[model samples]
Target: MTEDAWVPLALSSMIEVGTSAGAVVQGQEIVVWRDSSGVAHTWEDRCPHRGMKMSFGFVRGDHIACLYHGWEYDQAGQCRYIPAHPQLEVPKTICVKTWAVAEAAGMIWVALGAVPPPPAEAEVTALRSLYLDAPLAAVLAALPEGFGGTLAGQVPLVTLDTDLGTLRIGVQPIDARRTALHLTVAGPATPDTLLALATRSDAFRLSLETAGAAA
Candidate 1:
């Protein structure tokens, strides 16, 4: 067993009740989704059979049925039905791996290893999250200390910012050269302003990279 942490997976809006957010945490492919009952669930992205992606499967209330074979699994990642073998209790080997998951501040956080307690949301106001092509370092640099202290309303961050020792930024790798930076601004503001800042910063990052490439 290794030391584990619960990383913010996605913004609440990105994952609808019937949709899933695909992420790779600590090198493990994971799919976090919400069922029809309004509960969030996390499981390995791969199916036990034929390595089909379970994230593509459809949700039926509390169960997730594989899209390819219609095999169903429960919240506990237990294989509930085989479709073909409707009356038989599927063995454990047929189940997909799962982990403890919870929602915090309108976003879902999933632990990769021994999961910690669900994140408590007290002052953390749900702010919009975005996908950035740049790395976390670049994203932080672009911000003016949380964008010139704009995040006054957000609190008790779902993610722990180890670098700043204050608010945390949830950073996920999209590729060797790119990362998705999910950051929470302090609180309420003009959505138009926030969007403009994000957009401009992204454009600047692209320009910087292009300049670097030409050198």
Candidate 2:
């Protein structure tokens, strides 16, 4: 994955304020969280102190504390406090690797290095995410139409036009044969339209999985 490209990490709704979630992008484990102020942050899932998975940690104010040893790291990924040594200033070196994260069109995006430009402004609402046991290429090839844009020459993101409205789908590769399809529909999606879109997406995923199995 290119450092300058943004990969879809998770739906914005997946991470509420004071909460965190784990995600895998291109086989790299990532921890995505939202602070009390509603800002989203992403970092490597491992804690520097004990190599613990930070996704299991809890969020307090603007920081995430490791569940193992109570080591707290601020949004910038720098260790700020240690329960074992309350009065001691944490060493600057005790920090987790952080990544640039942005929320737009109701989706969370993260970059491995330099943050890419945000997607074009649009009036879109998140629909749903579907996971498939298929390769990213096979999934993209199976798309009906209007899903032609590629981010970083690998991630497949497409905008589909429907009678109800326009919809966007971000294709995230989980591994060699698994993927997470994140969907966003152009607003304003009525209850009926939302249901229709979701049904269509589910059908598409089913077809893809069936084809993969047959192959």
Candidate 3:
């Protein structure tokens, strides 16, 4: 993973406001959450104090409270309040590691360091995400015909020109052998079209997995 490379972490729909989801990028656990104001954030899964997984924590407005000791952290990853020491002002040094997070094309993107520019503007509607048991290279090789354009920095994107509209497909590698496939239609799409695209995507994933298993 390059320092400036943006990896698709999850679908924007996966993390609702005041909720958090755990995602893995290059084997690193990440806590992806959305604030009440609809802003999205990503950070290292561990809390600074006890190294507890923050994904298991609860959200309160703009902050996330660790389930273990009720340690509260703000969006900046800074320890805002410590239940054990209410009168003490949390030290700024006690902060969880954070990453650059952006949402576009109906997906969440996280970068280890600086994030590149957002994806090109498109009237995209997210269809759904598919999980596959294959390497990123295998998944890319298995992409159905018609995909061409790339989004953010991830490559081998599939762009299908359907009767309804153009469909863009993005793939995120969960690890060496696991992947998450995200689908988005380029223009206004009907429910029927979205369903068709999802069905086709599932079939494509099945074919890839079957071939990998056979190989």
Candidate 4:
């Protein structure tokens, strides 16, 4: 994906409130977190203080504290507190790089540069995010061979019609050699059906990886 493109990082259900997780988009590390009020934010995963990954930290109310030295950053990515130097006022320049974030179609998206028109709003049932040890192009090419769904939409966002329902999938390029697919159902589905779809996806992943290894 281009630097300006909005990349879907994770499934919306994956990052619970007051929780954070590490993600990679085209090789760039990012931290996805939600505050107490349930607003999601994305930022550079590295801490400016000691280069530690902010994903290793814990969330407190609306702030996320770096595990290294208890450096806390608010939802705006501004450093708000330092445990070691309680009386020291943090500089305005001390902050993490923030990204534009949005939630739609059961996925959390992050824009690396200028935000484009947001993904069209739709009601969807959250499924699961699938990661594969294969290139994005390869994964897309092999998708039809697996689920045999009628695929539609541009890259990074697509839909596949299956027996269960229409699957709204968000694609993510984790790197040159890895990709992620955030899936959600557009129509109602029972617990058993969802489990079956998930289980079938696991078989698809195994087959894809095995084929890549053989090739």
Best by lDDT: 4
Q: Write the per-residue lDDT of candidate 4 for residues 80-151, one digit (tens) a residue.
A: 999999998999999999999998878899999889888777888888899999999888888876866888
Q: How should the candidates be ordered by TM-score, best one leading?
A: 4, 2, 3, 1
Q: Write the per-residue lDDT of candidate 1 for residues 72-121, one digit (tens) a residue.
A: 88888888888888888688777888888878755677776787777666
lDDT of 3 by residue, 91-177 (tens): 889999999887777788888767687755556888888888888877766664423333233462456565556767666778898
Predicted structure 4: clash tally: 0
- The TM-score leader among the candidates is 4
Of the candidates numbered 2 and 4, which has the greater TM-score value? Answer: 4
Locate the minimum summed-lDDT window of 10 residues in model 2.
145-154
lDDT of each: 0.64, 0.80, 0.79, 0.91
> What TM-score does each of the candidates earn?
0.75, 0.89, 0.88, 0.98
* Model 2 TM-score, all chains together: 0.89
Worst 10-residue lDDT window, candidate 3: 144-153
Per-residue alpha-carbon lDDT of candidate 2 for residues 21-45, written as tens digits (9 for 90 to 100): 8888878899999999999998999
Error of 2 at 37 (Å): 0.3
Angstrom error at residue 103, model 4: 0.8
lDDT of 1 at 45: 91
lDDT for position 45 in model 3: 96
Report, for all candidates in order, the number of backbone clashes.
6, 0, 2, 0
